[model samples]
Target: MKKIPVLFILVLLLAFWGCSQKEKKVSVKKVGPIDPQMVQDQDDMTWEDYKPIPEISWADPSIKPKRGFKMALVAVDFPDQPFVITQPKGSDLFGNPQIDPIKREDVAQFYRDFFIKPSDVNHGQTINGYWMEQSRGEFGITEVDAYGPYQLPKNLWEYGLNEWGQNDFTPDGSKPKGRMERDVDSLWRAEYGDLRKNYDAILRIYASYDETGVWQEFGEMKFNSKEDIPPEWGNPNPDKPRWVATRYVPWTSWKAGAMQWGISSIRQGENSGTITHELGHYAFRIGDNNNNPYVEPYRRAGSGPWDMMDRGCFNGPGGPHKRWVVPAIAGASMPAGLMVRNRMKNDFLTEDDILRLSRDSLAVTGLAVANITARAVEPFEGEYAGVIVELDGEEPHDRTPVDDPAENPLSPGIPNYDYYSLEVVQRIGYDSYCPDNGVLLAKNRDKESRNGGVNQFNCFNWVIDAHPEDINMVDYDKPNGEKVMRTIADYRQLNDALFHAGLNSGSEFEYDDPYNRLHFYIIDLHRNQEGILSYTIGVKSLDGSGAAKRDFQLTAPKTTKESVALFTLKNKDKKAGLDASCFDNDIYRLAVSTEGEGLKAEILNELAVVSSGEEISIPVYFSEEDGEKSDVRITLTAVSESDPSKKMEASYVIP
Candidate 1:
């Protein structure tokens, strides 16, 4: 080879050395500390400043279909194969289950007569309710289940679907139903004292509750299944188990009744009364008809703690179908037909239902209504690096809301905060909001920082370092500064549950709620991605029934002042802080409605204001109406200059 020129040779050597020194980039998911590119203050800041210009926008989606009514069919195909339907040898106090084994024909007709057919105007009786005729569900039921012998599955008891033994419980580990199928008729026999009583009460008060002129909401609540779920462990055919119960098709989607019609081991028990529970799903799609311990919201679950819809209510006397006060049972009342119907269909408050449940959506801040309100919040982005939760915080204890804004200081946005009987230093503590606020609350105790950039409070998650007893106390071994982190093992079980439902991702995942966390009724922490990640605290299905701690976050609330013709929000100081409106502070609880794809998304960010990294829950809300268009993504930028055009920016949206 020809000898290289001295200058060229030196250049080649230098180039080779530079290439050798370069290293390959390894990917890491950990979002690093604020990128310098995120910094806009190239020069130190003066106290006074104006915001940088932003692309102005705001829009809202109108005609977003109001909750509409829909239905799905779930007929109980009680054993398509032949089975000997029997009954218990005796009767109960109700005289309901003394006989058995009529023909499948009689069993099928009974349900159709009770739930599917028109009540013939009850002739002479004053029949009322939605006679104005709101569309009742289109009724249909599968043919009677194919008759078959009581073929017990080898592991029926182990699975607990069959209530043969006392140990047989719910799918999520609750006590098993104790109703024995007695007086075996051609179909089956078993007394449903409380369950039937509830059905009669519903029939007794149908018109008074819904004088809308519409017929029975569900003219037909059908059931379809093998009419039996063999216990995985103990006895083969355990009484008459309701196979198809109330359930929602998608999240709040077309809800319908389900049941296992005829085909049972007990006598006189096989009738449509059992099917009434499932028919509730169709009639109201708001809750189940029967307080089936096997269902999700069995007979005692509510954000208010317990109700007649939570699982394991058989333990409570008067549960398992038994009405409490002989008049109505449970508390001072029973659930009204309007309760589930209005709440689910129109997001309306059902006075009668609230009255029956001994609760009032119009009197107190009913949790169901509150949940509906809280769900209105929009998210910051598609997914998030982590979640922020606030379970309990500094609010006066014994807070009694009186529906009217005049009685309660917090409602109607007067003070926008409620009065509490707590210490002065303990008002609006961290547990009352999403945990993201806690990250900032850690510094609230600092006497030097009362108004360190954060002036007013929005949610409980904004305050941190509050072992104030006023805030929820959680067990934590160690913390990684932003969020607590110790054993990834402890969280694995939750991770697995979410994963199985296609809710979350990452094999070595980690998350913690040190404070049990606030649930803003966004119900699920779900995403529509491949891993189908979400957060679940055992509310096994999409139908509403359970508490979830994952749907919380501090939002950047709204304000009257907005940047004119610019895509930016103003700061309370009357001065501009992220000139480009980088720190818009507007945020919300993300929830996906059934009418739309699970377009709901969420993202949380902790900004280190100026130099101090204090936590704060800023308020922010957005709608297509809030911006010029729905496609406009809200961006947050930080800059020292009055103009943001010359600064770096980062953004998150409710995509």
Candidate 2:
């Protein structure tokens, strides 16, 4: 090669060095902390500063359909296939089991009777009740033209359908295709030729075999090969150890291309809840809300048993598994309905039905109250107008008071980053079986975050449990010993979760969001005779100051009898709190008192400042040191600022 110029030679040498330096720098770069500007200043914030913002956002579907939604029902069967038809067996506490068989005509008629009429076949009702109610009567399967029990040329497996325990058989690869796809195509070709145009959706159901159903095998069939069959199966006409009926569909999917909603197969006694769940996916395009417990590591419950989108729809005394019994004995075990967020997204809730509170609106002093309606039902004209309260701080709710990176193996990208959300969870219709009714307080990060390179809080919604882990609440543990961490699983926790306040108003639910930036205090909760839940939520700056300050007057003891010191605590704070708005309640603690070690104080009437004029009696028990009738002066105080000393006080004489 020709001799290189001196400058070129030097440049080549420098380039080699630079590559080495770049490799060294790679190990040092780390993601920067959350922007300071994004954090809200907690120093002077108060409830008065909070102005609610709209929480619900209706979905803007690009493909909006006409006013009403209609669907076509296609019942399919295979050629000469030995389809097992089941009838109710001996009646017992658990009801009946599938033991008898019917003809193809009977299977087709069974589906027809299920959709066209309301009968005991489906828990003494039809799917019309659930679909109509869930869609708020806006959607129904008005016209169901049943086709099929129509025979297909392929065997059950070739058609991409198989009975439970029969899935191990493989195809010849003569026609390589996805089993489910093949099944859908075959059904569509046979029954959906001219009728696809008349409906907004399509439901394809098959008779007999349950692919995912939980059933008991009565030893009618042999586990070995044909040649290895047992002597009990001497007459293999019907094949001994006949398969017990169970769910046939392994998974539910939307065939957008064919505009078809197909089921692998419908068992004899399925309910409307299951159908509605599939409809939720097909009609609304909403994803399942239930957590994947089978996953590794943090197998946390997805949305848990609260939302219809989650396992809560399977809510009943016996839980999800009990739902399999045909002619459902558990009544309607499906979830009450969708959560507040889903309702808003689906347009089931109008703007007027919600109350929106945002961080910007919280700068001034004011009290906001909302009588929220149950999200499951169609919200009345204005129910959605006032239920939202957002306290967005400069810092995310989860990121403050930073968690050490080393400790959080699943470090959610930003620490303590969250926004607070408060809503009322009421028991009505499907929600009737919910463990308890209360105002649900939750924190959410609408977006995803990664810590240590793994997704944490993937759903981004965390319903703050008033009691995170109390045996009396949710005691059941998974096989791996992981507890079912959800509010619905526990009895007492769900009950205590309600903001039902009184003097002994249970425990205070405290959430420290934005690290040292903001605090959410669920001061009190109340429910009306109409079953509307209202919560008094307080937002304060980390500095312990807010527009709504605690103000109360402590009157002298009614009588210093029985070594008990009594004083009346009243809500005299002119600022007022959330409870003051509508369904208001007050909570007070003995901030400071001279009664010291010499006495014990007990709040006799559950701690609640029900009305502004109402007084809460606080009784202080005298210790042996003070004696029963000692002339002493005690000053009772209430919270005002960071230090309870900033609050108001009163002197009482125990005579």
Candidate 3:
């Protein structure tokens, strides 16, 4: 072999060493715990701040609907119970008057405007407006014909006292009178023979409150114990206890337990009802996404307060307890907008509205990044309303372990999820009543079904809670002053489930699922001039380094404030390497450590994203507990989410 120069051999060795170092992977360092105090709450939001949707009325001559539904609104009252509208009673049942009583014709017009016309009573919100907004003006109730403040043959208690062990407590000590549906439909049919065939659906506005709205407010929530329930609120038979067995909880006041729950069947509702939720079922066939909240062996909520099909139906001015208010101005009034999954199920979203990918394809595609607009508004052109990653490939594509919810209620149930979904929620439109606004991440199934086993509840959409630990919120105080904590399964437990970006934002910026071989990152948040929210998000497979060559450079720390150090991280790749077509942006997870006595350090922004040749600045705040001067050494590390091997670290020393 020809002799090679030693200098040339040295150059080859140096190049090989540099290349090896570039491909070397670095283990991720543990970051400090997120500050619980940093989490944001929706308490500041009020009805005044709500972003209004353009009002659409059924009576408008210029308005027309494409997939319009013509609904018939029939009001019926029992012989024993008169319409609350005509009576205008107090806060308590049949007590002193609160608002002035209206005539029967006025009641009919009230509902007419409530359902289809934008009016002051409905907060400029109507069923037609809700549907039109949700469907992007594609579907709505274009016409609603009002009929009948008619009277039914049976007594109010007869039809109302039919559920939750209330039949035995009837005033006559006889079986409950009859079905509200049969009696109400019979009355409507008697007047206009089989007239229901003319409309898409009939909305039966009955005489009292929706049982769901009053059950807790009047039951255990009202009285400390069953014995404390007043006789007036009890069943007619004095021998029977004032409380009766009810759904979820063990007992409730007889009156509340007896009242019928609002149902999709002929869409029967009451003065304080979740009519929109019923309309969801009546029109779209969307099943309830709720679980038994007050029961034992608690299970986590499915979609929680983020979806209309869930407890989000009870969203309005005040929290759930205020649902008993008449004319439905409080809870169960303006329900949350439909989530991406339900919207797709209802065909409300077009193909362009969702960016779809396959879990198997992600391995080849590297990391996928997109900006997702809030579900309540239209996405900007070329952006998506949501992202869906289909769990495709192996027989059991979802590798999540099935743990016992009885042991850990926070456990992800069943491990049979079909896909993952990501979308943003903003306090705009109907979502104005939602608890907070942030990126919503969840595991979902193609079809709605129960998880079976101990957590035998609906398992269609399982939201990944950012804070899985108990929120430790008190649901209510007993009459005796004992506090009743909200259960782990309570839908409100997910009130803080959203994932937010940036440091001190009162939410997590990223989630890692080693079992599912996926990592999700909420890189940043954006709000348009119109007050619509969107998030720049990234999803990468753990099994592969992304298709693009990932590299970044961190600048030396600069002191901006007395105890704050700022650093700029720039994506060093001048060009999209290897796969330019697939390259989006580089996301980095940052951590900081301090070496000093009584000193603590926190990264204001723990996660960052930079497009090719772009940069972002991160700030680290340091504090001393003892108020004593000491030399401090701060080490900041950045790890590329696309390729963990590309890691960089910088240190700043303060004397």
TM-score of each: 0.21, 0.62, 0.86
lDDT of 3 at 626: 58
For model 3, residues 317-379, the per-residue Cα lDDT tens digits are: 766776776777666667887887889998989877898877877787677788888787778
Model 2 worst lDDT run, 10 consecutive residues: 252-261
The lDDT values for all models are 0.20, 0.42, 0.74
What lDDT does candidate 3 reach at residue 336? Answer: 81
lDDT tens digits by residue: candidate 2, 562-637: 4445566676655434433542333444543555343333322222232455675554433334344344556666
Over 158-221, each residue of candidate 1 has an lDDT whose tens digit, in order, gives: 2223322223233334443322132112122122232322221122110001100101112111
User: Judged by TM-score relative to the true structure, which candidate is superior, 1 or 2?
Assistant: 2
Instruction: Sort all candidates by lDDT, best to worst.
Output: 3, 2, 1
**Candidate 3, run of 10 with poorest lDDT:** 1-10
Measured with C-alpha atoms, the lDDT of residue 192 in candidate 1 is 24
In candidate 3, which residue ranges exceed 4 Å CA deviation? Answer: 1-49, 53-63, 89-98, 555-568, 572-582, 591-603, 615-636, 649-655
| Separate clash counts for every candidate | 148, 73, 2
Distance (Å) between predicted and true CA of 87, model 1? 6.0
Candidate 1 Cα lDDT to native: 0.20
